[model samples]
Target: MHRLSRALLRALPRAPLLRQPPGPGRLLPAALRPGSRGGLSTRPRREPPAAPQRPAAQGPGGEEEQFVFPEYVAEPGPAPAREPPAAPGRPERRPREKRQHRVTGRPDPSVPPSGVSCSGCGAELHCRDPAVPGYLPSEKYRSLMGGQPGGSEGQGALGRVVCQRCWLLVHHQQALHMQVSREQYRNLVSAALRSPPRHGRRPLVLYMVDMLDLPDSVLQDLPQLVGAGSNILVVGNKVDLLPGDSPDYLKRFRKQLLRSCAHVGILPAAQGTGGQVARTGSQNLVDVHLISAKTGYGVEELISKLQRSWKCNGDVYLVGATNSGKSTLFNTLLQSDYCKSKASEVISRATISPWPGTTLNLLKFPIINPTSDRLFRRQERLKAEAEKTEEQLSDDEQKYLKCLKKQGYLIGRVGRTFQQQKSKAVIEFDPDELSFSMEEEPVFSSNKPKERVEFTYNELKDARWFFDTPGIVKENCVLNLLTEKEVKLVLPTHAIVPRTFVLKPGMVLFLGALGRIDYLQGAKSSWFSVVASNLLPVHVTTLEKADSIYQKHAGKTLLKVPMGGEERMKEFPPLIPQEITLEGIGTLEAVADIKLSSAGWVAITAHLEDKLQLRAYTPEGTTLIIRKPPLLPHIVDIKGNRIRGSASYRTKKPPPLVENLKANGTNKQIKRVSKI
Candidate 1:
């Protein structure tokens, strides 16, 4: 009978599921009850006795069909600290107590051992575990800590003491990554500003800015934190990614930078006929220099300038947001091919890597050149002497020429005496030579040299001493938003070759599945140019297909925005959408640029006919910033054919601003269906 009943149900069309009440109401209507002639019950006319009410039971799907409410959890309390047990033979090392200044080396009757800072990476030294940073073997740590600076004649006595991790990284170019928090960065910036320097040296602040990711708001914060006593030198790093050599573009960029800095209360340097700063009406003093630490472009001149200006022994503090190239710049500043630091000899422990937070602790390296101010004075004397003819010289000048002859700086030699008198390979300086060329090849810090120093930050004596601090984790930068591989795709290692697209109404452009731009409604076909890492992929699709393509290919192929690999990244989060409406300041100005946080931006070329509308999409919690194109040269170029349909393209476009668009969408979707 049971088999026959199952067969009959299968033979019949599917019936709708029904909810039955408790007690007498539990019985379905005679016509609708199961096992009835027609899904109805004839025997159900007899009802059961009253019973205690119970929680509702699920239907056929059981627990799979029902949702259980999760228990609420309160906020987390302060973390508890645990100390690992010690092994025999080697005693357990306790957490380091606070100490006096590493630079001053003056022991506070208050603190002991000055808590070990890795002479290599500057992390506090420890021997508890090899997996953690600043780890050293117990015996090695004792030997290093017990030794004195310049203990013996050999370089090993004065060798740099690095953690085992830094030693491996320097030798093998490996990365032992760390996740740094923003609060730690705030502490470092505060310390850099408030920490007193050695007696005679003034604190010269080098605030490094990542040219590609610098926002206007960050520029403003620089002045407030760096107190008025310090002179601020802004280094716009990663010029290797900036495009073009057009004077017109540079002219525009200079003005834009000046304007932005002025907006932030940081003024350009005081103006003279040939002064570095032009009167761009700003309150605080600043000098800007564009450099490429990766390529060693413009760094030499910057070094010479800084070294010449502050003749007084001044402490140079390198401060910048994470991935701002501060470590690279710091390394380059200390690189010397001369006798002291050889290409094969190990020197600094400041770790340089694409991985954010690679630098955990503050590290310092002293570049105590025996002849300091004398090098600059000699260069000045040589330049003056080089400009004069042999007959145009006085007896004193002749004596100088004779000295230059001894130093091999004659009419044929251009930069033979450049680095210094004590430096192994000197600059060959010839009177007729227009450019200064090094006698030996130029050395770069990127070349991982063998280990050399055992010294700490204590050896620096006020002479442009470089203090490397922790990297600040930026919240919106694609580097922070994307995973390690994704960051490589988004950050340009070489010059950025640009990509551009032309989209009609209803078309959308997906930037490596990380971001999307919908051309909701425009006067005509819209042209959008993109400038970012050449390695990052871009794709386009209709608004209807964009959602499906993104949902399907997200992490597998469109891998830019996903935070990690595996199923989590493949499950692209639903985009948090926003509609941007643009308006022009001028009657004729209708176009504007919209930025996608650390991702590149798009400039909308709109007609005055109607205000353009743009719908932007990004992962939830990710910041999407819209601003005018920055005053950067070659941020965008229209030098490519319009890309349409489902293909991706590249072009160069600078980031800044545009105008006149009406945003049309809910936070979830635009929901606008315009005429096709």
Candidate 2:
């Protein structure tokens, strides 16, 4: 019966098992309820009369053999409530900040005891004296007053302070700020140009051309300054007023300007009665392009080219005349939809402005290789050479050696040792390293008698490194009367005495207004010839801006400017056909349809037979080479997919975009879709 009782209690309800306590309820029948699975009793039932249990025997190891585990009694628990899903835009929770009191400086036993003078009074005392102004009562007191992490010794490294009254008198005078004069600013520019550092890569010069009157004063010597093998992109400002649809317009203008330039001994080839002597169908060279910075039309192309050049570690400089939008271009390049800024930090008293004559200053910040201390040191030395006399001991050089300085780069001084104590001395130094043959003679023609001045580091280096100086100095004597302010105003005008000046070489990049050729009333006096004759570059591109300027002016009685045998007459219907072929490195894909003003039959088609090529021929069977494409490396996508050959071809007009249609003619029509 007792065994039966134990087995029966095992099946009793769990909730009431402990409460039953071997009472009459333990024997109840309904203790097992349906669907009460986990709710069953966990407690063992107690028998009214039970036999005592025996302990298990120990094993050979003398350890207890067996044990019975205690049963768990379930207690009543609170029911859990359902929670709703979180909102989509809610931010994740973050940990809180911790605030703690930090300990100040501790005493270091290694440091030696030293005495300090007090700024408050003339008293000098040991570190331990409390009465003296310089005294610190103890290490603890010193640490508290020093307010340094490492206590008294660390504070002492910062140097001793003066007595309060003395300190106030010493610092009472307000610090005066002096801005760099225009002349000094120009000198600074001369310094930078004289010592432009090698960036380990070619630099990119954004050659900006004034769409209207490109002054002979600005960017007139760009070809020399930018150096050979440098990427100089020409961008024409102010194009919003011109027609953008005509593609051939720019080409015709280039041909006309090239012809005009040839007359003045500026352009490379002379134009005959016919257009540029057809090269017997040889390959056409890469050409310059037009873009209006004021209108933001071709800026995208310029940015793309700049980015590509920068990828190869090229440095880009904004070069242009005053008010030609150099600063505007910088702002435009920096501005985005997300963040807008005035970007006025570019300005400093010695800063080079976009204004003509003032654009000479160039600032270089270490963006790529910051670890190159030696590189910067070499560059600084070069700059110092531009400011100091030839063979003279510069400050940095003086730190190591003692040597008599020559005027400029030569070995000579102004006055005699006794009779003529002070006289004018001029030193001409070659600032540029790349151009070995440049004339470094410091010519002195003094507006006033020249004077000698000792060269200092911070005073000259700071200006030399930051300002723009683009003018040529004709003289060498340093004028005593001209203050820094007076120099600043005259530097831009190229009117300063050249004798003691940091002379800058003139550079220029000309843009031939190809599309505007026909519209030009005085093609002979165009700005292109002015620049070409002066700051001539090895390479030039005539950016065709119009479709057919000559064709439109053809048969009209326009004034003719004869360039060699080529006449800049009214537009003419050329007997030659309009044919263009573009060849480059990779495959050429698509081309636009050609539009000829003369209206002659033409055959135009594109081919990918060997790489990508575009071929065009006239009805008379004349072929023209547009350009040769650049070779590119094997291209691929992020997903291991291949990227097809890319080429953008433009003709008389841009190509129109086409839409795809379904095989079934049941696709919705454009007019029908508009209603929805």
Model 1 spans > 4 angstroms off:
1-116, 129-132, 136-161, 164-180, 197-201, 216-220, 269-283, 311-313, 336-346, 367-464, 559-566, 570-574, 583-590, 607-610, 630-638, 641-676
- Candidate 1: C-alpha lDDT: 0.54
lDDT of 1 by residue, 537-603 (tens): 5666677777777766777644444634457564445578999876423322225556676766665
lDDT of 2 by residue, 1-676 (tens): 4565666667553334444335533432345432334433444333334433533333322311111101101122433322333478987545456543332333343333344433222233234323223333345434534544345564453233442222322344211122334455344433443345454554444545443222221343444444434444555554322221233433433443333223322223224565744321111112234454433434544543443344343445555444344544544444311011111222212212221232223422212121245335434543443344323544765432222111010011111111213446675665563344323543444565333233345433322111112323212111111223222221221100100000011111111111111111211111111111111111111224123423343222221111112243222112343323332222222122222111111111223322222122221222222211100011100011111220111111111110111112332331121111
Model 1, C-alpha of 355: deviation from truth (Å): 1.2
Each candidate structure's TM-score, on Cα atoms with residue i matched to residue i, is: 0.60, 0.25
- Considering every candidate listed, which one attains the maximal lDDT? 1
Root-mean-square deviation per candidate: 26.1, 35.8
